[model samples]
Target: MTDTALSLNTIQVGANARVGDYLALLKPRVMSLVVFTGFAGLFVAPGTLHPLLAAVAVLCIAIGAGAAGAINMWYDRDIDAIMERTRRRPIPSGLIEPAEALAFGVTLSLFYVMLMGLAVNWTAAGLLALANGFYVFVYTIWLKRRTPQNIVIGGAAGAFPPMIGWAAVSGTVELESIALFLIIFMWTPPHFWALALYRAGDYAAAGVPMLPVVAGPEVTRRQIVFYSAILAPLAMTPVVLGFAGWLYAVIAGLLGLAFIALAVQVWRETGERAARRLFGFSILYLFVLFSALIAEQALAPRFAGLPGTGLGLWG
Candidate 1:
């Protein structure tokens, strides 16, 4: 029995050398946001979903997102090795070989799409698979190295989770889903550019042509503020459009103010520290903003039919 156990352990360790590292290639932090936004889309859509099916749909979305991340790491290994931000990623760090990461991503992508089709509806599953493919083939392969607008265009990949979630619930797309998609799509540029402003040197080192690296920090700061200005109104649109409650409206308004204030500070301050501060605050802004939506939704049942509950828009 001991000998057999030792043999099995040996096999596992050897297999790790071949395949384990590739799993680390997936950017799990990014995947978490994808899953969260997808769930939010599912929850907010005006429909019922069997809990089991909802769980399966979210799971498949997560796996598909991770697959895209793995493929991204595989493809970006060259520049990743030079970028301080990505130098330690699996493929660049020598923990995983690029081919292994590619294979892992491809396998998981196929599996998730097929399983989603079987477990959920084909439309939702197909969209999920398409998002993965777009992230890998379009963003990573075509856009990243070639263009400064990489993030602007590639942001669509990240924005799809909510759409995917909406599709999972409705089995179709609609204006509401498109609204959710637009909100995130607009939100992404300012959020990422803040990071890019502070990390311009890293991007320059990596040859990644991020806006900040190419356009200069001051230009990036102005762009960040500009985008934040655009996003501020868009954030409140749900309220105006009668899609959210006052609770969400108030939260969105307050967070939007804070977000704009941070961007203003970033625009004025000429230091990396300020950029870092704005970057951190941008993340909090997004989390709190989304959380407001979830919270209002949760409280809606209790507040239903109350006069002020639906008052002043988005109720």
Candidate 2:
């Protein structure tokens, strides 16, 4: 165990934990992406829902994701204090005590799960709750410190939102929702590895077993390209599965190819710049992919009714 871990109870916490500190625990910036993806999944699922109810479901997912983030910050405070990238986080910076952050996270997590079950469907709520538990126990407590493959397995927590959103409408999961889950699951390694490549020093200093810290940079770069190759082709599955249309296919194709190209650049290069660009582009790539789904769901209906358009499979 580390010194911080050994002396956790002895650490002095900041006296005044402000509103901003509480919000910081939630990792609000990442929460925005979760909200958008969750909403898109619910919106595009083939079912009718009252707009108010749909809003509630999205809110539950956002809160659940944020709650998970808070717990992650709480548990990882020991290492966070060592990493430059995370040293200033709420718990690590001493702005919030670990006990308080853990309690806050647990409270919000239970409330969000209950609200989702009451307002939407139990399946969605179950998925929401499961995401948080899995993130904290499987990812944070176990894999994060133990293995280089932490993000690969832990990424499942982040991928669950879209599926939970799909369940909010359909009340059950389907092959289509699984496809969305896989898209994000595969995207995570390359996306996270890109950042890890550039932030190797942080991981090394923090004693976190991120790929770049455990595996050589060359291996990490290769893995990024390897995952990107799989993600590119897999991104088109929604079209084939009947949930998306040609517009989505076209957009996914372009973006997928561009993603592969960026991955290749990262693989060939020996510096942080390419890795940094891939990290930034990965965020845009995922956002555009989901947005394309929204666009196709809205516009694909117009062309589907016309025969031979080859747009919407269900239409």
Candidate 3:
């Protein structure tokens, strides 16, 4: 092949690589949970938003989450390169430039927050902006490398979605929305510590002060049980608050128990597998708990007469 033609082909391949790499910077797996929880908040809120506007609200949340993830990848590229789990990420893998990722993240963050303010209520937009800022500044920059309590406080960023979702419809933050926020906030420590327990070596190598890396695995395991114990009851806050019904109560109770069971096993077992299991189950537990709330809310109109349907405990 001619040298010019070969050069052109190489350029094309590089361009193609960037396309996918940019998306990877957004951390789509994490974005999915943000979207689901945000939607759940919107779905269960007391008032109604136009379907089109509702879509916009959810889209804004998703984009805001993605924007934060991109910025996180940009900021953490150094430690990400060192950590085994994140070594192949876009910036660390050299598929994308840090400057480009930062620009992309900042652009999306501004765009989504503005779009939310214009399309939805400013309350929701403000919360979205707060979430993005907290994730980028508080969690990624300040906390991640500084303290073992990183995820404990940083988890607040992830917890904002439901509150934002509620504000989208209600035009104000409510006690029920705060209950949703607390669920994820409390769940985050146990969920992340489980992974940290198993990946303590990677955290230490990266100089990230994850719980297990700073304290021993035994301490991490104990902390996990402690957080899980709190989370089990926190998950039921919706039912107690009268926003969710017995359906949600029962499912959340079961899931919370299972979550505690897994945490206990992580504490007792001397194997990484136990930690891994807790990590995996923690994801399922949150997903199912939120899913139960969505289901109960969605079915409430149709099953109004049924037990544990429309009225909730107080209604």
Candidate 4:
């Protein structure tokens, strides 16, 4: 028997994988962000979706994202076992078998995509399929170990959720949806690189070529600042394009400045604390940006006369 088989056998003995262990394989926290952004896309799209259909769309997105996370855990078990932050994950910690995780992920992927096509629309289903495939085949298997640019390029997978959500409602991809996609795409590098700065040691130990480990922290910090600069203006695209109102513009402007300021702090400081701060705030920054969009959309009727109310633009 192969050593890997023997190891699996040994780990399987007396193993007690539970429901929560299975959930852990899905990476719920990451799934939450995906669902939120996907919902934002759906909510802000120009057309209306039946509330029931809308719920299905969001559910499909959440499950599809979780499936991708599960597959990632299965494929990266080796590196995950090596990384301190990931060593205790279900598969690596022997709470769940690798093959089981893979099968679970594959099943969920098929379920969500097929359901989306049947219940929602084909365009949304196709995008969900593409996103699942990209996260699994492209990001997890292709770029992760081979390139420092993995997250930069693979971020497209995450960026697809909003577009899919928009398509779910509009039944087509549009310029406005693309704007949402760009906002997330451009925000990814700086957000991830900040975490990479503090987690360089973990990534290096696992042999994953994250930017901070590959090009050094100094370069990573600078890149963070560069992306933040571009993202600051990019966040205001909805207002510039006439879909968003002045309220969104003002909120986005203030948030963008804060994002850039934090990025600059990361660039100037030599300590990991600065990187950690950026990492924490990056999550908040995105949550707030999208929240502002959602709020504006919800409140548009009541505040129609206010400047930049985002009221009349939707078809």
| lDDT (10s digit) by residue, model 4, range 44-133 | 777667788889999999999999999999999999999999999998888888898999999999999999999999999999999999
Model 2: per-residue lDDT, tens digit, 140-171?
99999999999999999999988998898889
lDDT string for model 3 (207-313, tens) is 99998888889998999999999998988778777787788888988998888899999999989999999889988887888898888777773442222321122
Clashing pairs in 4: 245-308, 246-308
- lDDT-better candidate, 2 vs 4: 4
Q: After superposition, how far is residue 138 of candidate 1 from its true place, in Å?
A: 1.9
Which regions of candidate 3 deviate over 4 angstroms?
A: 1-16, 301-315
Look at candidate 3 and give me any clashing residue pairs.
Answer: none
Each prediction's TM-score against the native?
0.89, 0.92, 0.92, 0.92
lDDT of each: 0.80, 0.88, 0.88, 0.89
> Which segments of model 1 are wrong by more than 4 Å?
1-20, 301-315
Clashes of 4: 2
Per-residue lDDT for 131-152 in model 1, tens only?
A: 9988988889999888888888
Model 3 is weakest, by summed lDDT over 10 consecutive residues, at: 306-315
Best by lDDT: 4
Alpha-carbon lDDT of model 1: 0.80
RMSD of 3: 3.9
* Position 221, candidate 2: lDDT: 93
